[model samples]
Target chain A: MFRHVVLFTWTEETTDEQKATLAAELAKLPGAIPEIRAFTFGPDAGVNPGNQEFAIVADFDNVEDFLVYRDHPVHQAAIAEHIKPIAASRAAAQFVFQA
Target chain B: MFRHVVLFTWTEETTDEQKATLAAELAKLPGAIPEIRAFTFGPDAGVNPGNQEFAIVADFDNVEDFLVYRDHPVHQAAIAEHIKPIAASRAAAQFVFQA
Candidate 1:
């Protein structure tokens, strides 16, 4: 399986309502992309001692499926219409695994 | 690289000092495992609409290396001595990547 894991930190200045909207947009993608078997996102609990916050974990069946998910039209649309609008900063780790 | 990513959530009743100690314990494993190229951990922002918390993102050269890290004495010792004592709940997603 291939996994695309991203750590997203939205600015603290963001309102709770906005966070809700962002989550909604993320949810829309699973139905929009066939390669995405599982997509999960959540808030940062401020418990760890490091530079991180929200995380998004998306799983694919294989490398091709992952790359497809990465380049899917729905993904591009989501980035252009939703995610990029409010994200303060983001970092990602793409893990390519054979299982 | 093989990545073993885990999300750990400690009880809210847990104290800050104990959390600090847990982070220190996790940090030690990187030095102990030579195959490990990168390791990162942090708190859950609680901004996402999901069931996740603290996250551990560890990268290894290959699946064998990750399995080694998983079985290493230092890792086993940390879980036995530190993590198991304080964690309230935890979930993990292991990603095996070719690149």
Candidate 2:
């Protein structure tokens, strides 16, 4: 499986309502796009002081599938409409997992 | 369960051998610390041009258990010995997972 991990640091001005909306929109991606095999995302629990404000861990069969999700209209809409405006910084990584 | 996600960017000087050592040591955490219910770490597969170089997604029963693994001598040793030196920057997040 290929894992797509993204970490987000919200801008100071971002509100809880905005975050909730982003989460809700993100939750809809699996149903909206068939390529997304697994998806989990939420606000950071703040156990580590250095932690970002939000995270997403999504799985796909391969890079092609991941790109399908990435370029899907729903996913792009979420990024442009919800994520980019409120996010201060975004860091991401992808890796292949065995077992 | 609580998910602990950490992303790392290696300094330009970091070598593949050093990264392999870090991954090998990280793979041992589940056995060395029973509180670590799940642990996965590896170099980024580089499908995304903007992605960081590495990531770790781990799970624990709760914050207390997560801390046990965090403060474990073996984990600390790995960070101090293998991680800090080569890591240029680190970003992390934790969240509760329903499943």
Candidate 3:
């Protein structure tokens, strides 16, 4: 499977409500995008200090499937309308592994 | 389960051999640390430009199990001996979700 993991640092001004909304929006993606094999995401659990504020881990069968989810209108809308507005910094990586 | 996602940007001085060593070293963790439920990691697949250089996604049954993996001497040694030297910047987040 191909896994795409994204780490986000929220802006100081980002509110809890905004983060919650983003989470809710993200939770709906697996239902809307069939290419997504598995998806899990949430805010930091506070286990460590100085960690990124949020993370999303999505899995697909291959790069093509991942690309489908990447370009899907619903995912794009969520990023543009919700994610980009409050994100201070974003770091992402895509890698493949045996399932 | 509690999921830990970490993103790392490699220093320019890092070499392919070093990265391979890191990957090999990380592969041993699941066997050494019983708390690890699932682990997947690799260098960036070049699907997206300007992404972090590498990522590791690990899962545990709960925060306590995750903490065991986090503080395990073998895992810590891998970080100090391999990861810390080449990593220019690191961003991490731990979160929970249903299995």
Winning model by lDDT? 3
List TM-score per model, in order: 0.51, 0.96, 0.98
What DockQ does each prediction reach against the true complex? Answer: 0.05, 0.83, 0.94
Show model 1 residue runs off by greater than 4 Å: A1-99, B49-51
lDDT of each: 0.69, 0.90, 0.95
lDDT of 1 by residue, B10-44 (tens): 77777888778877888878787888887766554
DockQ: the better of candidates 1 and 3:
3
Each candidate's interface RMSD, rounded to one decimal? 12.4, 0.8, 0.5
Worst 10 residues of 3 chain B by lDDT: B90-99
Order candidates by lDDT, high to low: 3, 2, 1
Error of 1 at A25 (Å): 15
- Candidate 3's displacement at residue B37, Å, is 0.2
TM-score of chain A of each: 0.84, 0.97, 0.98
Give the runs in model 2 whose Cα sits over 4 Å from its true position: none
Question: Could you say which candidate leads in DockQ?
Answer: 3
Poorest lDDT segment (10 consecutive residues) of candidate 1 chain A: A44-53
Candidate 3 residue spans exceeding 4 A from truth: none
